[model samples]
Target: MERPTRAWVLHPDIRGDDRRRAPEPALEEATALAAALPGLAILGSEVVRLPRPHPGLLFGTGKIEELGAVFAAEEVELVLIDGPVTPVQQRNLEREWKLKILDRTGLILEIFSDRARTREGVLQVEMAALSYQRTRLVRAWTHLERQRGGLGFVGGPGETQIEADRRAIDEQLVRLRRQLAKVEKTRALHRAARAKVPFPIVALVGYTNAGKSTLFNRLTGAEVMAKDMLFATLDPTMRRVDLPTSDEVILSDTVGFVSDLPTELVAAFRATLEEVTAADLILHVRDVSHPETEGQAAEVRTILASLGVGPETPQIEVWNKIDRLDAEARAIWQARAARAEPHVAMLSAVSGDGLDAFLTQLSQALRGPESDETIHLAYPEGRALAWLHNEGVVRAERTGETGWDVDVRWTARQKARFDAL
Candidate 1:
């Protein structure tokens, strides 16, 4: 039950000389996005590069006509524009190309629509899509009943007609928002439970397809969606990553950030983003082999800043995908990371190279002051045992003559509890 596939690329050469000059990165990003839909049978894809940007249509008349010809020749069923398209422009493009039109926002929405796993994720996607559709009501709409009542009169023939499409979209928006609020409450409850566990959260965030899920799976030994495709992981997946010292910490893999993410999508996904904002540490994973890694990193930073996870946050730069790079490139990256101490580490999540070093660093950062005391308490005093379970890692436990014999490493606050007993 897979949908029919049709794809096209429109890297609108926007007016800014510096901005338009970065075509290679856009192509690379698009390639990653295309790879995400491996199951879809893409007939063909053509990159439509405009000579210059046009605010209304994004591309010039000549370029649009030229694309129209190519679409006809290829029998393309969809046009994927890299830039945002206005309602008028989208309608015109659909009519001329005789296909469904999708800009970057729509494309991202489509991906989210397919990848959303949890109930909250699905609700978020639906809300975003509905909001987007509300704006496009002018382009394709239905006939509506007209009302022609006088200013003081209650009844008469209808003169003005309400836009059917707009009314429908508004109604849908209200319903979607109500559903999302319910889902938010459920997520809040789950988050509260995690907070009580006393485990610090570490969230993995980066540009799309940066191997966040792969690294997450390796660290936590849990299978998440990891692939060589943009947005391979959508819903935020959390698991307990066991540290070398036998300490368990909550690790989360979140939706990857992309350049120019639609505002609607961001607003909808705010609940999932709570993981990032609440994180005690942030791992910004980057694909070191990508030539445009710097630009990608900038994009991720921009999105994070918008989410309020600013520069002050405790961030660890994870230079991932090292296995794809040559020895010289690897050396260069290693040097770069060294110069950026307290913020960087180079590793290949796929091959498991340099993971131990990364993990050692991660554990040390998460660890607090060492403990000296060992205490034993009775089974009936289970509240104390539960408190110890959360405050520190339990090293050993056994039943003794009087009570439970326990050996553990705890913080000063937790060690003080023993004196209270």
Candidate 2:
């Protein structure tokens, strides 16, 4: 087997910046990102304090030289920066250190490229990658000085290598957009079919590695790729799940959200995330044990709001991974959750603790407001009676001389389905 490439992660702690996060947790998250990619063995990680960023080098010259020595001593093959790195800064850093360098966006693109399974997901990643690469064309093409003499048919002379590469990338993006359109149409058709099935869709969303897939597997009893790694599941998966109240729902597991998610990726994956927009209920699964859980939840909410998921959409906060917390912390959180808002549920998806309560809550959320209705059906309409019985919606039934009078408590969707039957 090929040995894993040696890598180092660095998180720049920008002093005096109001938006700067705590350096330690930021560095830890960056290291986790690097570890998520295959074929990369992290050698070390650190938080570099920067009073101010240098425009060209991103770091002080002394710091660069110092880190260069460390990189050399450690035999690091790749260096990942936890924040944005301009193309010029990346080029200069790579040249000075003589090693491969990837900024946060690039590292995330690599992870998405590796994890995407479905055709639409792969295409979206390719488009985003191309878009990202288009900006770095200057650093990529060493032959930018070379000019091509174009014929009259090409309509331009003195087109540099960079321009040619940009044009090629643009063309590739167009092609990808067309292919994505086709896939989106097919997905829309599938969604339309599901709409006819009379089952509400419940989407699970959270920050990366927040145990959404684990919760999904626990609820649906289907094996999905659940792991401790970031971006463990990129493609959306759906399964029919019967909730504790005997109401069936379509449960959807989506790609996890992250802070500072690349704009190119967000636009590219809009179709995949549209499932969330159409959902009847959303479960915001969170790793309650993480120190930055609140910050992570804020990021997820920001992304959702940007996707047009607003106050009108029903949502439940699923406080997951409580098993990882200490006994005192867990009890404290549980108490807080109990006294908190109505839609919050504290549970560990791994050990099945509090799953029953969660499912019951989920059933209630998806069921919406229920009302009792009395209907009289003739003796020949056995199918309608069987449908109501199978749905567990019948409150009471009385037989008469020619027909039956039934009292049922159901949501509008259930009533509609029964009427159609």
Candidate 3:
């Protein structure tokens, strides 16, 4: 087997910045990110203090020399900076340290490139990566001085290698955009078909490694890729689930949210996240066992709001991973969740505990006003009858000489679908 690449993670702690996160937790999260990428062995990690960023080298001369010696001693193959690194700074750092360097955006792009599975996902990542690379062409291509030969009659001077490379990237981006548009249209059609169904969509959204996929698998019985890693499940997955109230719902597992998520990723995944926006209900899953649970929750909420999820949208807070907590903490959280009924649910998705309560709350939140209605359908309308039965909306039925009388207890959407049929 090929050995893993030796890597070191460094989280820059900007001094006197009140808004800056705690250095320890930030460093821990960065380390987690590094571990998520396959074939990377974390040699070590640290929080590099920076009172102010240097224009050329980001770190002071003394610190540069110190880290260089450490890198040499450790035989590090790559260095991952946990924050933004300008092109010039990245070039200088690599030159001084004699190792490949990846900034926060570049690292995320790499992870996304590795994780994306669907055609749309692959296209989006490629487009985003190209867009990011376009900004660093100067440092990326060493053959910028090369120029193409041209005929004197047609052109005096041909384009340089850098210009040609940028043009090629831009052209590829355009093609990718066109292809993405086609895929999006296909997805829209699929969504439209799903919209015609009576089932309401419930989306699971949370921070990375918060067990959204675990809960999804527990509820839907689908083997989606769920792991204890950041961005483990990048492509969205959806399945139909039967609730306690006998109401069927479409549950969607979405990409996790993170603190300071790269802007390019946000824009690139907009189509995938539209599932959340179109959902009839949103389940904001939280890993309550994490030390930075509140901070992560805040970040998820901020991203949701940025996506235009208004206060009017129904949402349920799912406090997941309670199995990881101690008895005392679990009891306290359970009590709190009980008091916050209909809005919060404390559950361990892996252990299948408290899931019934969550389903009950989900049923309550999704169910609209109960409407009892009787309808007469001819013998030829078996499709509608089967739909009502499949949706678990039929309460009673009576057969007559000419037709069948069906009584259904359903929500307004179900009633409307029946009416349409």
Candidate 4:
């Protein structure tokens, strides 16, 4: 493989900024973001304290010159800023440091562009990139059409004016949305088909790198791309899983949330996250071992709220990665889980230690007063057979010259619908 581009991360901690987070953790997250994009080697990262931003340069002259020297000596080819960078600031910094600069939004858009797999995902990323591109003060995000990969932020060409770019971007966005709509319509048909099924949907959501995919894989036996990187799973993956209660459910692992997620992405990926909204139960998987776990959880809740996931939706907070904690720390987190409001389950998805309890709790949470029921129908009663199949309650079906013998298990509610049929 070609040598990875050397990159540095800088978190500008503006004084008295209510939105600011713990500088250290923010820097760490930023470093992870940079490393997430393939072919980028993180040389180093730092927290740059600023009483006030320089508006035009984003940093003082002395600090710029100082960092520039370090960049030159270290041979860093790229700099990833942990927050927004205006077009002017980006241009000035790139010239001052003589290295390509990528703001947090730019970096994330690049990763989404790189990681999106499905046709809809690719279109969503393209639309988001274009939306982000249309706002540039200097250079826009690399032309996504280049398909040159990774948003080409490191060395993108074709910098243009907004008025001209706006027209082009608007047109491209219209085309992309049209394509996305067709893809979404297909997805909607699939979802409609699934709606006819009796299986409840359980969605896993949390901060990126919080081990959701790990938990999802352990429960569903699907090899989704689980990694120690940010935004590891961009598109939602779903699998049919039978819980401990023998209750089959549609388990969905969705792209994880992040602090200060690019607004463009939040809006663009809304449809991708629709699974969470329509779920019967949501598993809010959390990395309980991180020093800033609470903050991360808060961010997840904020984003969920934005998506209109109201209190009416039942949710269980899955405190994950307890395996990373010490005995004492583990006890404290376990205690917290025991008493947490709503529902909380403690487990290490990596280790099988607490999985059984989690599964048992999951089953109980979805439990209902339902029992086995068998229905016999003739081949002429195809409508009833289709209903049973559509309801996903068919356990076994035997076809005879006269009719079909069908075994089904359903709740009173579902059975009522079958009775009506």
Q: What is the C-alpha lDDT profile of model 3 across 323-420, one tens digit per residue?
A: 99999999888889889877999989999988897888889889767888898989999899999898888999999998789998988877777787
Candidate 1 vs candidate 2: the TM-score winner is 2
**Among all windows of ten consecutive residues in candidate 3, which has the lowest summed lDDT?**
147-156
lDDT preference between candidates 1 and 2, better one: 2
Q: Rank the candidates by TM-score, best first.
A: 2, 3, 4, 1
What does the lDDT read for residue 374 in candidate 4?
76
Q: Find the 10 residues in a row with the least total lDDT in model 2.
A: 146-155
**Candidate 1 CA-lDDT value:** 0.75
Model 1 lDDT tens row, 308-328: 987666789899999999989
Model 4 has a clash total of 1
Selected candidate, larger TM-score, 3 vs 4? 3
Model 4 lDDT per residue over 1-421, tens place: 6999999999999998889899999998899888899999998998999999998899999999899999999999999999988776777787788878888998999999889999989999998888776666224344321112125522234544434556877999899999999999999999999988877899999999999999989887899999999999999999999876666899999998999999999999999999999998899999988999999999999999999999988899999998899999998887777778339988899997789988888876765467897778988889988988876789999988799988888877578667766
lDDT string for model 2 (1-421, tens) is: 9999899999999998777997898899999999999999999999999999998899999999999999999999889999988766776898899988788988899899999999999999998888877766644455333211100011222337568867887999999999999999999999999988988999999999999999999888899999999999899999999876778889999999998898989988999999999999999999999999999999999999999999999999999999899999998998989887568998999999988888888888777899999999999998899988988889999999989999999888888888777
In lDDT terms, which candidate is top? 2
- TM-scores for all candidates: the values are 0.81, 0.92, 0.87, 0.86
Clashing pairs in 3: none
Off by over 4 Å in 3: 138-161, 371-410
**Candidate 2 regions with alpha-carbon error over 4 angstroms:** 138-159, 396-402
